[model samples]
Target: MIRHLVLFKLGEGVERDDPRVLEGVDAFRSLDGKIPEIRFWELGWNFSDRPIAYDFAINSGFDDADALRRYLEHPEHQAGVTLWKEFSTWVIADYEY
Candidate 1:
């Protein structure tokens, strides 16, 4: 199994209530149901003061690297990717299980 994790820091002036933020979160959470390769999905907004804490985090599970790649190319995932590029300042990742 593969675990795909992503942490995002929103761009300047972006807030929790922003449509872009909500759309990004909903888009990610919906992937498990929309894409076959996405076995699990979890997304959360940061509420901690830790420097490592980003604006949002996403954790996803896949059966293998191929499945993970497929999830990355999925249409719904692409929409989220576009939204991420528009609203995020930084994105960090680690993919290992």
Candidate 2:
């Protein structure tokens, strides 16, 4: 399986309560049922206020690279990406276990 993890930090001057951020978060949450390639999906806001911590995270699992690719190309996921890009920047780590 492929474990796809991502950490997202709100953009400078951006707050989590911003309408755009809430919309983006909802968009991602909605993907749990919409995409078939996803074997697992977990997402949430980060509680840490430390400067080095990210504001949110996405922890997902897929059957393989192709499944992961399909999830990435899914329209709903892309829509979330578009919205999140407007208010946040993210880093990702993918690995197999």
Candidate 3:
């Protein structure tokens, strides 16, 4: 199995409640049941007040590299990425377990 992790930080002056940000969050949330390649999907806002924390996170599992690739290329996921591009910066990591 492989774990795919992503952490997102909102752009300067961007607030979570902004319409665009809300839409982006909803887009990602909608992916949970929409992609067959996903073995697991969990995402949420960070509640931490620490300076080093990211504003959002995506923790997902896949059966293998091909499954992970399919999920990455999925249309819905790409749409979500487009939305997020307007207001956030992110980092990702993937590894086998």
The model with the greatest lDDT is 3
Quote the positional error of residue 89 for candidate 3 in Å.
0.3
Ranking by TM-score: 3, 2, 1
TM-score of each: 0.88, 0.97, 0.98
lDDT of 2 by residue, 1-97 (tens): 9999999999999998899999999999999989999999999999887889999999999999999999999899999999999989999999997
- Once superposed on the true structure, which residue ranges of model 1 sit more than 4 Å away at CA? none
lDDT of 3 by residue, 20-96 (tens): 99999999999988999999999999999999999999999999999999999999999999999999999999999
lDDT of 1 by residue, 1-97 (tens): 8888887888889888899888877877777688989777888888898976788888888888899888889889899898888889656464667
Write the number of the candidate with greater TM-score, choosing between 1 and 3. 3
In order, the Cα lDDT scores of the candidates are: 0.82, 0.94, 0.97
Q: Where does model 2 exceed 4 Å of error?
A: none
Reference-based lDDT, residue 53, model 1:
77
On TM-score, the leading prediction is 3
Native-referenced Cα lDDT, model 2: 0.94
Q: Where is the poorest 10-residue window by lDDT in model 1? A: 88-97
